[model samples]
Target: MRDRGPLFGETVLFTGTPKSPEVFNLVKQYGGTPISLPLIQVAEIEEADDERKMNECSHFDWLIFTSQSAVEAFRAKMLRFGFSADLIHSKIAAVGTKTAAALEKIGFNVSFIPTVFSADTFVKQFQPETNRQLNVLFLRGNLAGSLIKEELPFHVVEWTVYKTEKQLSSIGKILNILDEATSVNILFASPSAVHIFAEAIAASRGWEGFTICAIGHVTEQALIEAGAPRVDVKPETYTLIDLVNALARRKEGL
Candidate 1:
C-alpha cells in the first residue's frame, strides 16, 4: 500500500555516516527520501605519541565518553595497545544513550549520564564528594569542544581518540547532489559538521539555493559564522528522528 503522509512529497539529504541502523531506518520511515553523503571520514591515530595517551588511562577517576565514535576508537586503541577492559578502573560516564550503550556492550557499566546531553550538562551533573577529588579523562574526537574542561573544577585529561578529516570526494558528490536538488534541506548534526559543510561549500563555490537547517544552537551559530543563511534549528535532543519530525511539523505548518 502507498503511504500518504506529512513527508510524502519531501526529499531530504542526510550528511555524516550513520553508525546505527535505527537512525538509518528512521530517515526512511518518515515519508522523505533519504540520501547519505558522508562529508567526513574518521581515522584512528596510531602514532607512538598517540598510543602513549591510552597508557595513562588508569590515572583518571572517571573516564567520560562523549560519543559512540569515541568509545569505539578508544576500545580499538586499547586492544591494539594490549590493554584489557580491567585497565579502566575509573568509573565511566557517557554523554548520551548511544554512547552509554556502546560502553555497556563492552562490559563497562556506565556510572553516570546527564539528563540533558551536552558538554555543559555533563559537567554540571558531575559532583565531587568532599572526601574524593576527581580527575576525569575525556575521550573525544579532534574537533571536540574544550567546554567540559572549562566548566569542570576537577582535574581533566583529554584524549583525542579519533580524528575527522573532510572527505573531498564525498563533498564533490554532495555538491553534485545539491546542484541537482530542487530544494535541499541540509541538516547539520554538529558544529564540526557545520564548519566542514561550510568549508566544502565555499570550496565548491557556494550552496546559494539550498536551505540550511542546523541541528542545534551551536550548529546554528556555526552556520551563521560561516556566512550561510539559516532556515531552521532543531532542539537539544540531537537525534535524527527529532530533526526529521521537526521537518515534518514545519511542512505541516506550510
Candidate 2:
C-alpha cells in the first residue's frame, strides 16, 4: 500500500459510534483501510427519573449541549414530556458545529459556539464575568468530563441525558482486524474511547505493533494514563475531518 502513497496501505481502526461517515470515506479514499470497532454503545435513558430531570431543564439560564447524542436525547425527552421546542427559554451554547447544527435542525439557534471544541477551551472562551452568575445547564452523557462544571465560576446544573458502556464483544472484531492487517492506526475520538480501546487491547494482549492516534489532548492523556506508549497526539480540532486531513498531511510529509 505504501506503493500507492504514504497511507496507501495503512489500516485505520476507528472506535466509538459510527456517527460520521465522512471521515471513514476519506480514509478509504486515500487508500487506507478503515475498520470500525464500536466500543461505546449509546442508548437513551427511558427511566421515569430521567424523564423528570428533563422536565426541569427549562429553568436554567443557558442550555449547553456537548454532543449530537445529547441533543437527540434532550429532544426526545422534550417530546415525551409534551414540551414544545420553545419551552427552553434559556439560550443555547453548542460545543461544535455538529451539535449546533443539531440544535438548529430542531428550531433553536445556538447563541454561543467555541472555535475550539474541547471543554477546557470552551471554559477559557466563556465570559462568566460578563454574564455573572449565569446558571448554565449542561446536557451530557454519564461518562462526560467534569472540566466545564469544575472550571465555571457560576452555578452549573448537569443533566445526564445518556450513558456509555464498553462492549467487550467488539474485542473479537478488533483482534481479527489487527491479526489480518499489516499495520493499524487506532483513532481515538474521546477519553472514553481511549479507555475502551485500552481495555480491548489488554484483552487481546496489546496492539504494541500498531500506531495509536488520538484526536485531541484529553484523549492523548487518557491513552498515556492507560499505559499506551508512543501515542500520536493531534492538535485541538472538533471535527474528525480535521483529524483525517492532518493524518494525510503527515503521511505526505513522511
Candidate 3:
C-alpha cells in the first residue's frame, strides 16, 4: 500500500465483473480515484449449454473451478435441476484463493486449492499422478478459451456454464474520464474483458491515451493480443491489491 506514494489522486478505471468491488476499495487505499463500470456481463449459458453442463458434470472425478462466476453459475444451474448431491463430485479443486472462498461460501468443502492464482501455476502444482485416464470436469464460460484442456493431461469434459457479454459504456462516461483525469489507467483482470473491449472500442475506436494495467501474465498477453496498447505495468502477484500497487509504481517511472 505504501509504494513511494505515487498513486496520490490518480484515477483507476476498473474493468472487472460486478463481483469485483474490493478492487475499487483497494484503489482508494492506494490513493487512487477508482472508477468501475463493468465492461462484461456474466450470465448462465442458456439452452444447449445447460444440457451440456448437466451431461458432463455428473461423471468427473475432479471438478475444477477457475472463477467465482463459474462457481455461482454451476451452483445456480444445479439448484434449478433439483440437484441435491449430484451437482459436484466429492473432490473439488479451485484455481485460486478467491475462487476457493466462493466455494466455501456455499458450504462445499474444497479438497484442493492453489497457492498461485494462475491457470499455468495450478496445472503445474496440482496435477496428480494417475496411471489411468482421469476424467476432469471444467466448469467455465463461453469466453474462456481451451487453456484448461491444453494444460491438463487428463480427459476433459468441459461445460460452458456461463457467458460473458461485452458492453461499451455510454460515450459520456468515456468523455468524462478524458476530461477529468490526468491519465487514465484501465485495469483488466480477465482476458475476456480485454477481448470484449477490443470487440467494441479498443481496436475499432479511439483509445490511444489510456494506460493498460493487466492483473497477471495471461491477462497481459491477452491485452497485447487484443491489439490494446502495451501494458504500462503488470503486477507480479496477480491480485487486485497488487495491481493497484503496481499502478502506483507506474508513476515512479514517469
lDDT by candidate, in order shown:
0.74, 0.79, 0.77
Candidate 2 yields a Cα-based lDDT of 0.79
- For each candidate in turn, the TM-score is 0.87, 0.89, 0.83
Candidate 3: list runs displaced more than 4 Å: 1-5, 48-58, 82-87, 170-172, 204-208, 252-254
Tens digits of lDDT, candidate 3, 49-123: 575557556577888899999999977876777664435565788987778888888767788876778888888
Clashing pairs in 1: none
Alpha carbon RMSD to native, model 2: 2.4
Model 1 alpha-carbon drift over 4 Å, by segment: 1-3, 49-55, 82-87, 202-208
Lowest summed lDDT across 10 adjacent residues in model 2 is found at 125-134
* Cα error of candidate 3 at position 208, Å: 4.2
For candidate 3, which ten residues in a row score worst on lDDT? Answer: 166-175
Question: lDDT by residue for model 1 over 1-254, one digit each (tens)?
Answer: 13565556555777765677675566567666767776777877566775677767778888989888898898888778787777768889898777898999887989898876777778888785657668889887998888987888888888887898776677777787777866567777777776778776755677576656665666667778887755464755766667777876776666
Better of 1 and 2 by lDDT: 2
The lDDT of model 1 is 0.74
Candidate 2 residue-wise lDDT at 95: 88
- The residue pairs in collision within model 3 are none
